[model samples]
Target: MRLIELYKSVQGESSFTGVPCIFVRFAGCNLRCSWCDSTYTFQGGKPFTEDEVVAQIEALQPCPLIEFTGGEPMLHERELLPLMQRLLRDESRRYTLMMETSGERPLGEVPTEVHKIVDVKCPGSGSAFGSFRMSNLDALTSRDEVKFVLRDRRDYEFARDFIREHLQGKVAEGTLGGILLSPAFHQSPSPLRTADNMELDARDLVSWMLEDGLPARLSLQIHKFVWEPQKKGV
Candidate 1:
């Protein structure tokens, strides 16, 4: 598998936020979002075998939470699927697995045991806008989560309409795991650790959510505030 740096860090997004987790950041992406921070993962990464990757994961010790993230981990599904299975099926120590993906990929074959946190690109995502694969919505089990990175009211509206139009039934049935609306961060945020660095204020997003009574969680990329906004890894 083409691999970027694999390290232990707290999960900065999703319902499992703030939990200590190992991040497996893979290289290469098919889509480009304007607010993307991991553009460095688009290409050029060291290659490692599945066994080697597992070894690296084991080195992180008793921490059992692992997340497969990337430019797009599903793009390397040929390798990622097996890796996830290995972690879940480990006889000595089983790991709770999660994946953060751009929703542009087909998730039909992903193991249901792995929690999927999918991103639904908003209009402000530049070329990535409206790129989510509608069919992937069918694969969302109660263990999965959908996220929308908002930059403005337009983006929020898009996310709102999508949930109302297509996800209403699953949400009402409690079959969908969660819906997260995180504000976008400036691609090049200042080194300062402050809310001003954020492209959209969380307060504004919360207000909008309150006004509409949207059944979505207000997610902030907690890792950004915990470290330098542009820092790699956690």
Candidate 2:
């Protein structure tokens, strides 16, 4: 596998926020979102075999949660599937695998046991809108989550409409885990300049959600508050 940094940190997003988890960050990405924070992963990272990756995780004793993040982890599904299977099959380890993807890739290959967090890129991401695979919506279960990173009112509205059109009913029916709304964190080279609106604060997003009565959880990147925003390996 083309491995990036593998380390233990508190999960900063998704339903597992604030939970201690081991992160397996894979190198390389297919899209270049203007607000991407982990551009470091887009290029070089040390290589590690599947066994070596498992060994490193095993060394992080007592952590029951594991997240496979990226540079788009789904891009490595062929390599990641077996690793997840091996970890799940280990009787001594009680690891709950989580895979975070951009939602641009197909989720059909991912295992049902894994908690998949699919990010439906808002226009603020500067990635083409509607790039998400709509089929993945049917693939979701109560254990999976959908995230939308908002940059402004337009982005919020885009997410709101998407939820209303696709996810709201399923979420209400309890078939989907739930939707997440996060304010797009500004990074170096500034996506704010490119995004349609000015800078947005968490309060801005909250106000929009309140007025619209959107059915989603407001999430902040907890790790950034806990550590330096530019820090690597959380």
Instruction: List model 1 lDDT by residue over 39-100, tens digit each.
Output: 99998999999999999989998789899999999999999998888788897887889999
For candidate 2, the TM-score is 0.93
Q: List the residue pairs that clash in candidate 1.
A: none
Worst 10 residues of 1 by lDDT: 163-172
| Cα distance off (Å), candidate 1, residue 86 | 1.4
Distance from true location, Cα of 195 in model 1, Å: 1.0
Worst lDDT 10-window in candidate 2: 189-198
Alpha-carbon runs more than 4 Å astray in model 2: 189-198
Q: Point to the candidate with the largest TM-score.
A: 1
Residue-level lDDT of model 2, residues 1-234, one tens digit each, is 798899998999888999999999999999887778888899998888998998999899799899999999988888999999999888888789999899899998788889999899888888546689999898999899899887788988899999999999988999889899987766753323332222567777888889989889988877766766667898
